[model samples]
Target: MTNRKIYRIALEVEAFPGMPTTAAKLLPLLENHDSTASEIESILKYDPGLTANILKLTNSAYFGIPTRISSVRQAIVLLGWKRLLQVVMTICMSPLMNKTIPGYDLPRGALWQHSVAVSVAAEILVNALKIPDADEVFTAALLHDVGKLILGGFVKEDLQQIESMVTKGITFDVAESMVLGTNHAEIGGQILGKWCFPAELVSAVQWHHDPESCDESCNLSDIVHVANTMGIMTGFGKIDQELALEHFGPVADRLGLAPENLEDMAQQTADRVKKLMVSWA
Candidate 1:
């Protein structure tokens, strides 16, 4: 629980391979209004496997595109640049995410399923609440818990102490910090920062488990926090901590979400995740 230990963990995160090369290159381009579809195509063309997966997702029932998408260009045009970026990131990150995390007790594919569910739930909240400034919300929710990948081994080493704190009524993440001096949410933010994601996106991952710590001007963290809770409620993610619905009241009120809204969102999230996972799997 020393700074040296945390420093070593930070070194490991930096050493971890970041996003796929092509996907990394295309992220900023897509975020820019001046960038062209052809530019995106140019980068993706080299990664035939990624291009094929993108096309596959576009044609998948989850997207609901009426026409077949044979090429990246066609998919880009139909899904628009932003949606295309989401699909590209999803496909690009799936391999890394679809793994077991011993620290959190997430089995192979469990983390991916939870990540996808949270992403879906985040968008559902956005539209339901009629919030307009959260274009990065989906990706933020998807990659929210990515820090588990790095911290799993360390967590397993200290699981006993962590669990003891949890039994005493401290939240799991808080226990992680008390025992490890760093929790998955904070490390996840570091991972995103290494990937060069925007500050808001990084904060969303950092403060997801403790939205109260997030800057008040940004609600992306609050959105992801609720979505993560919803993901656990739907039984998609690992749940090491006791969940208290009332704990979310303040964030819910800020988002204009009623208690009933969370229930409705949980149901809708489950249904959407079910269909998407069927096709995605």
Candidate 2:
């Protein structure tokens, strides 16, 4: 894969060299039952800014709690441990996702919007279809475009060429390769692998833009691909001209989504998503 343009682009990024060490320090705490809420709270207490940010988001208009939740402990109790962990992971990666990348035409928070929307879409899809491990699916969908973080500076420099090709009706992945000699999929997978995300998730991001390539072995990645394709269709993160509809055709077939039912489901998902957009947006 080293010679592949996408993989080559990942190689150009200055990835974290001490990620495993940091993971070793923290993973055991999350993995072992010994780490309690108090322990995690104690760690957060020192970082007042972090704690405040978390609390703010928990009580934000997006979450739509009946009453205000003013503390991390209360937020944890209300949101639950699983959701809390997700929030932590989101916060930890904010620096990377929020970084400016002019090449991709992404503003400071553009990637974050896309990431979070895809995550919510994945969860919604999994729940509707009764897909297992929905949280993991949500996590993978959230980070699917993580490669953009690594390729930020590079993409900013060469986006004109990429945009030109995209305007000419070239596929997004093709445009990325043409402009940067790499694409987001390879870049995202490497970052997640280095950070010890589950292998399946890494694979989902690496292959989401191309589900057929992933179906040779299994359908896990295909699930994510469809979720993302739905997001694309619904214009979650962009307002561009018509996107290629072919990306969803075969996957919908595999998933057995009847053509007649699609429009209604899309509307339902959009309505569900709107409720939280006030706070999140």
Candidate 3:
């Protein structure tokens, strides 16, 4: 399908079932460098379900706080604004991402697991490399493959052809483009733009598969590219391994990461994913 057709399909879909209005309202607050705990708590209060998820997550073993968190404000205070925003985004997007995507060969919850893994990996890279805008990168990583959700049925239909191209040495995204006329990365970027996400995030999603194509000044796409590849290697999901490895070295180098450092970061990301899975459970 053409890009226009793909976007038309996305627009016709059910408004992405798990996109809470609360998320849209919370975006500005989360983006604000000086946003207060009370400001976050106040917005979350209107969404009882989201508020409950936040409190539950804050008290979970993953957070490891000494006392239980009973209220949104208390959770915010305990988790701090940045961490709280991560939890909220994870909670808000989980339901939509947790389902099976047979087109991509993802079983129920597999995509969600991969997303979490990538998010963790992005966080590790951000801190390790001392990159700024950790929250934006994390959120972008979590939603990096959202286009897969949109393209699932089409991919399922074209699976054999796409696989054949991959077997003939084409990268997965290239195969996807050949078969579907639009790759998941670009579709994901368009979807996020439609959702009113910041341009940084839209660019990250759009260019993660080919970070070299992103603007020279932004490292967010490069960070997500490395994280997504790491997540695939760690078995969060399957993809063309050769294609992934091809980009691995260059992407890591772009972030000034040595192989040893990248390996350590991958291990840290895996551990974080393990703890996060428990919290989700």
The estimated TM-scores of all candidates read: 0.95, 0.78, 0.91
Stretches of candidate 3 exceeding 4 Å from the true structure:
1-18, 241-243
Shift of residue 260 alpha carbon in model 3, Å: 1.7
lDDT of each: 0.86, 0.65, 0.81
By lDDT, the better pick of 1 and 3 is 1
Show the colliding residue pairs in model 1.
Answer: none
The residue-by-residue lDDT of candidate 1 on 1-281, one tens digit each, is 87877887888898989787887898899888688878888888789998888888888888789998898778877999878878888888999999988967878998899999999899999999998889999999999989989988888988999989888988888898898899889999999999988899999999888888787545999899899989988898767652434458888988999878788889999988887887786
By lDDT, rank the candidates, best first: 1, 3, 2
Q: Compute the lDDT for candidate 1.
A: 0.86
Cα lDDT for residue 217, model 1?
41
Q: Clashes in model 3: which pairs?
A: none
* Model 2 lDDT per residue over 1-281, tens place: 22554554645655444342322343445444456778777677777766777787777765678878888778877887666665665555566576656556777777776676666667666667776554567668777887776676666666677677778888777677666666777777777787777778788888877767674433556667766666655567653411335667887777666667655555655665565456545
lDDT of 2 at 230: 63
Can you give the lDDT of residue 6 in candidate 3? 64
